[model samples]
Target: MTMTTDMTNSTAPVKPGTLFGIPVGELGWFASLLMGTAVGFAAFFAATFVGIISIMAINTIGHHAIDYSLAYKRIGLPIGLLVIAVAYAYLATLWTKRILRKA
Candidate 1:
């Protein structure tokens, strides 16, 4: 068996990427909020679906009953809210600073 690997040069210069003439690091707060909202919305639906599946599996295999509302009210809501808040905060901090520096 022969093995090969690509080596990276530490001294090589790296370039920052840009979009629409704006650097990636300088994404705006509205963009951040939009991204967060999208993620949170997805998470909410995913969590709800998973939770319901788990509950159904339990009901079938263990003869245990779980309220479907628990998925949305407890598991899904908290996860979605947390994701949205964290994502928005992180992106806002990174993008908003560019504005302050310019002003």
Candidate 2:
């Protein structure tokens, strides 16, 4: 007599922390720090780009030309993006924890 068993399926789900397809926990502390910092900087630059475009649009619609008069206006975007990045990183980590709990 012979007995057969299937081992191809898992009874419990697996959860892994990921950001942009990179397993967050698998990367050691230094690598994770680098990845997070890169994400933060990219977010900041993207926000700056959007801000510039917004300012240009406002100036063009209001005065029919590009205007670069306010320095404070330019500063807001980077600050806002920094906040967003921090919140995003924090939330992402929290989310990872929640997902891991399901495993």
Candidate 3:
């Protein structure tokens, strides 16, 4: 029986230049930072909108059961907002990585 040992490493070292067809590297870091900040701002705006809607709903529906439901809805807002934030962050990271690969 002949045994073959795995000797080849498939992972390639990151080169400083174009990566995945986009120009990046150090510049990519700055771009990613900017993108993250922009996404954060957008998330904040969305959260604010949701908050306003929740407040209006609470004001309009003054029943006890409705108020309890509103509280539950408000609790969901933060989770939804967090999901959005994480998705945005992931997208930004992916974009940055692609750009870096190209650069």
Question: What TM-score would each prediction reach against the true structure?
Answer: 0.71, 0.54, 0.41
Model 3 is weakest, by summed lDDT over 10 consecutive residues, at 63-72
Candidate 3 per-residue lDDT over residues 1-103, each given as its tens digit: 9999999979766665445744433444557566555656566566656766676677778742344344335654565567557755665667677766789
lDDT of 1 at 79: 91
Candidate 1 vs candidate 2, lDDT winner: 1
Candidate 1: tens digits of C-alpha lDDT, residues 3-76: 99888766634444343444545666777677769889999999989988988898899988788899999989
At residue 36, what lDDT does model 1 achieve?
69
lDDT of 1 at 25: 58
TM-score-wise, the better of 1 and 2 is 1
lDDT winner? 1
Ordered from best to worst lDDT, the candidate numbers read 1, 2, 3
After TM-score superposition, the amount by which residue 35's alpha carbon in candidate 1 deviates from its true location, in angstroms, is 1.0
Please, what is the whole-model Cα lDDT of each candidate in the order they appear? 0.78, 0.62, 0.59
**Candidates 2 and 3 compared by lDDT, better number:** 2
Residue 40 alpha-carbon offset, candidate 3, angstroms: 1.3
- Residue-level lDDT of model 2, residues 1-103, one tens digit each, is 9999887966554445655565564654456566667666666666667667777888877875655433235654556567667846765675566657668
